[model samples]
Target chain A: MYYALQILIPLGLLMLGWGVGTLLERAHYRRIHRREDQHHHVPVTTERQLWNPDLPIAESRLVRGQVVVSVDYFKRFLAALRTLFGGEIHSYSSLLDRGRREAILRMREQFPHADVILNLRFETSTISAGGGRAMGTIEVLAYGTGVRYAQALRPPAVPDPAAD
Target chain B: MITTNIETVPGRTILEHYGIVQGSTIRAKHVGRDIAAGLKNLVGGELRGYTELLQEARDEAFSRMVDQAQEMGANAVVNVRFATSSVTSGASEILCYGTAVLVE
Candidate 1:
């Protein structure tokens, strides 16, 4: 009975993690899609220069956002199994996607007055927890210069409805 | 002081270039936060503690880089860039670098 209990406990935890993790990931993806759609007008670019070169810069500031996401036990378990086979571990992809999108959204939220974000870039790192070699959490950071063009340089378009 | 990732700050002229200035820091979370992060991993969500940890590290690196630019008698830093890497199991390094320049 003792041995059976030990097996049952870990199995139960794995199932629970799998179920809850899937639900959470789906919800996060949905939220990311909605936010991306809402902020579609806020052009994000990796180019070091602003979109309109003639536009004079009224204000420019560095804006950054970081998000740390962890993998559920079940996904980690799958990843571990994949490691043995030496194949792409698909389970971790969503974790990175969520982290990146969340970080970008947060950075955009910081600059309510900025018209666009230029030179956008992303940085990712693994944070190991519990002193284990396995990556326990993944951190994604998005940063860029938020630029607000001078009034004379403001683009002649319908003001972004989403803009405050 | 003016700081920008672009080579030149719009509407400003670069009068003198003072070469590159950089700063870096390695940081790790406390044991409590590490344990919390481990538990948080079970359900798979954002670990706020780790996020805060990296943010603090980046801020520190940025300030230190700015300080170096100031010491060089530069009023601005241009072409700024940030890099982050995991140095060890628990520790991560954040580096900020840029060219120090006197601008007007």
Candidate 2:
């Protein structure tokens, strides 16, 4: 009876700690969400300034130059392996898309009139141990230059009143 | 500083400026197999923190590369590579780097 009690006591304490930790984390997450909702805003514009070429662009900028946007999260290494066999990149779609949009919005705020940005890039990397399931973090960063396209500025046309 | 596109070799002089770009992400799951494995770790073994650490390091290195690229007046970067090394039992570092060049 004493031996059973010794084992049960430690297990119970561990479970209690895990529960409390999870509750605290959930509360923190909710507060962050509320803050983000309150801060969301964007300006509306109708001028057709964007250039549309017949051919597709090789790259596009998400934001102005010298700016960096990052998103971080954690995952288990073993779960990553399962994703490989599934062969579907969709699992990461939402995370990447949201990061891209948020970064672009921030960039627009920084460079309101800039039209063209270049040298955009994207990359990913992983670090894992050979053990069972473990916890790890993921981070996403988006960056690019912001510039006004040259064509946007041109000399105004002169009126010929004599002909009228 | 002129931006160099990573597409071509630069003229005489070892360019010192650098540009950096990077991306990172993390995910978690409660699979039965993972649960069983964690249970076994009660005896002893490393966890999955390496994945998170590597992602963070990669982002940092990419940022540095972008900075260098911008200094060199490069418009883009290419031929990127990643490397990793163990800093300690509980920590590791991952790096992502590439060549910066000029493009038309």
TM-score of 2: 0.35
Q: Candidate 1, residues A1-164: lDDT per residue as tens digits?
A: 99999999889879988999899888988999998887766777788876576766787777788888998889988998998999788998888888999999988888867787888888887766545476646788888887887873446335567887
- DockQ, in order, for the candidates? 0.67, 0.08
On TM-score, the leading prediction is: 1
Give model 1 RMSD, 1 decimal. Answer: 3.8
Interface RMSD of 1: 1.7
C-alpha lDDT of all candidate models, in order = 0.83, 0.40
As for candidate 1, its clashing pairs are none
Residue A117 shift from truth in candidate 1, angstroms: 1.6
Interface RMSD after interface superposition, each candidate: 1.7, 11.6
**Candidate chain B TM-scores, in order:** 0.95, 0.50
